[model samples]
Target chain A: MVVRGLAAPPTPWSKSLAEPTIDETAYVHSFANLIGDVRVGPNVLISPGTSIRADEGSPFYIGKDTHIQEGVVIHGLDRGRVIGDDNREYSVWIGKQVSITHMVLVHGPAYIGDRTFIGFRSTVFNARVGEGCIVMMHALIQDVEIPPGKYVPSGAVITTQQQADRLPDVKEVDRQFANHVVGANEAMRPESR
Target chain B: MFFPPLQPVSTVQSCVSGDVSIDPSASIASGVLLQADPECRIVISAGVCIGMGSILHAHGGDIVLEAGAILGAGVLAIGQVTIGANACVGSITTLFNADVQPSEAIASGSVLGDRSRQIVLDGRPGV
Candidate 1:
């Protein structure tokens, strides 16, 4: 990729992030943005107008067969979590088969589990989301723990553990919707021919 | 060439500075400003539609918009913002914090500056 030099340089922000990585099997749209130490997994669908920046945290990862849907933005955290005794640094980690909906933003040192569906215009900040969870539209998840298979209702804000624990279980149909997104995006890929 | 040319990749009188990464399938409309500061970057993902007159800037953090997302006209999302996949943000909306869930729809004329809070809108809201 060519980093075009401006006639008159605007600022020094251009080289903040290292080169991004996109797997061969992943479907990254022409207009999508992936900057700095970001790793997009196989069969993943990164839709139009989306952006993923890992400059601060470094090494943001998306698991296999996940869907990072439109207009989504992901930012890395200033401090990374240490995994076990290995001292491994982790910032933002999105699991496999996750569905991140439109206009959503994921900020800070967050961990989203596998097969989760984050709804439209929602915000997730510094939270830990469990697997197979359904975060409904306009929901806010901040510094909370969403147990596996929980379903957050629309406009629900989960600020504490009590609110997250009170949520219902994820429906089977909603999980299927997340699964179908993968195939649908492959069909929409440029090389689908 | 299968890979699109990078030279003149950005148009529409948009003032672009620093390091910005945009996917080929994404459409950056007119009157957009994409700027990156010393410690931040801008990455626009696939199938993204950045509406006209939108300003995406980064100061000390990065800006990333995931797949199938739409930033409506005159929108301003700055500093450590991550718009998730399939998200549809209405025109003139401003997002200051970070992280929107997948497929989330935000109405126009909205202001979401707090990362710990969520903005809820059903049908529409605007000036």
Candidate 2:
């Protein structure tokens, strides 16, 4: 059985509609930290020294079989940005089998689709990444919509609408990262030993 | 340097080789790793808040974190780096060879990788 090392926030912070939930099959490393209002799916691997804080504006959701690598940071919005007549808060969604690599930063309200690979040291801020996308290392994804199967090169900055329109589809060879990262990360799990 | 009162919530697990000092009223969160080389030193000044999983390594050079600097979660720093007073470093930022100016914000910054550097596009770096 996996130990639940995740902690609930203090009183005033807890008063928000934030709740923390994790599936029993997930693997969260002992050194990793998860703050309030985050939901983790099954077979997820939260690697060592990673922090996912949803204390601010959240109801963050991690899709099944996703892998959050070492030294990554994920935060909720400073305030809820989406306002409907009903005043409901929408969660930031990370889809199934996604690979959020080492040193990555993901800030909501962001939606990353299934089988996507967010490379090392990349930043995704207030963006929507479609299914099967590859965001390479050192890339900045801000306020954009990366279409399905798109491949963003390393060190590329996608901020302008023109730049978002100019992004290319993933090369066939690079699709391997999206295909294998989930199983590759699962091998690093302690129970796999 | 003199030590300050450590909060009960802070977790300090560091491996030191040389001189390392931290001021009082500093909050070093859980899972932080501080390493000081035999020759160099690491110093964290007052009112600094180091988020969880930050690695401060002073192996090749000295590290000085001035007063009121904030290091967000999963930040990595090494070498002769000085985070000036009241500066804020966002999460996953690496100051492997950096000198952040005081009150500067290094927001979601990262060093470029070998693949990005190795591309010989038109005989110059980057396309």
Candidate 3:
């Protein structure tokens, strides 16, 4: 279901009442909710039980071919904003071909670059993850910027810049695994619609 | 002066199921989910505010939210949990079998209670 945001605000932020703009090629499942000031790019698959709400935040952008798995939650704080790859301010910016696995929370102000794979149940809050990164399950990434192609192991907590910097680069096997997952999900886009 | 009484207008746009009781003064944002299994209950007291995209699932036990409790966006409260009155749980926090004290403040991105089963064993060094 897709709907409009709040018409008025009781707080300093959340003043916008804009509706979502979804491309025709995107497949949003019936049980998924996409509300207010959100832009869904082409060929994106929003699975069931997912919530992409931009009511408090002004705008969100999901690039083409990204897949948001079941029970994933995407929301943003009204106070902060991130600069997208396009150089504009956004509440959350998810780049092309990203995979947000089941039950993960991608809270803004957050930026996830292209081809990044966030594993199941991970939380990305107030952080910037560069292109081709792989974040494993149950990991918490907060208030940090991860360089491109980095690998975050499972159950790890990366809160500071030093920790993110010291992380190892993505292995070839991990990259292949992420690509495989993306490919598999992309094949299901037609069936999901 | 003739004044009309204040009418309680609480809006809930979430998907709710099973034995759930929501007070008329409670505010539930869009995309919030409340699921209670058989023989379990989820109670949202008066003045409670559940933020957008938060999920509350009661499994094998009751989940209770005391009056004026606030759950920020993307919070996941699973299993048995009790949030005391005026407790504020920040965004993206996960609670499992937690009993928050009254007026307690939980920080954002915090994971409280047991998550042993969810831990994944990665063979990578320096993790």
Of the candidates shown, which would achieve the greatest TM-score relative to the real structure? Answer: 2
* Order of models, best lDDT first: 3, 2, 1
- Collision pairs in model 3: none
- For residues A74-182, write the lDDT of model 3, one tens digit per residue: 8888879999999999999999989997577888999999989996578899999999999865688999999999888656888889888888788887676555434
Output the number of the lDDT-best candidate: 3
Candidate 3: where is the Cα deviation over 4 Å?
Answer: A1-16, A179-187, A191-193, B1-127
Which sections of candidate 1 miss by over 4 Å? A1-16, A82-88, A176-187, A191-193, B1-127
lDDT of 2 by residue, A1-193 (tens): 0111224335375455545798999988665667787889999988755668777757777878899976677876875443212344544678898899766788887888888898766788888888888876667888888888877766677776666776667777667544432333444566754
Tell me how large the interface RMSD of candidate 2 is. 12.3
List per-prediction Cα lDDT, in the order shown. Answer: 0.67, 0.68, 0.76
In candidate 2, stretches whose alpha carbon ends up further than 4 angstroms from where it belongs are A1-17, A80-89, A177-186, B1-113, B116-127
lDDT of 1 at A123: 80
DockQ of each: 0.04, 0.06, 0.04
Order of quality (TM-score): 2, 3, 1
Q: What lDDT tens digits, residue by residue, belong to model 1 across residues B18-63?
A: 6898898888775466766555789989889987656776655788
- Give TM-scores of the second chain, every candidate: 0.78, 0.76, 0.81
Better of 1 and 3 by lDDT: 3
DockQ of predicted model 3? 0.04
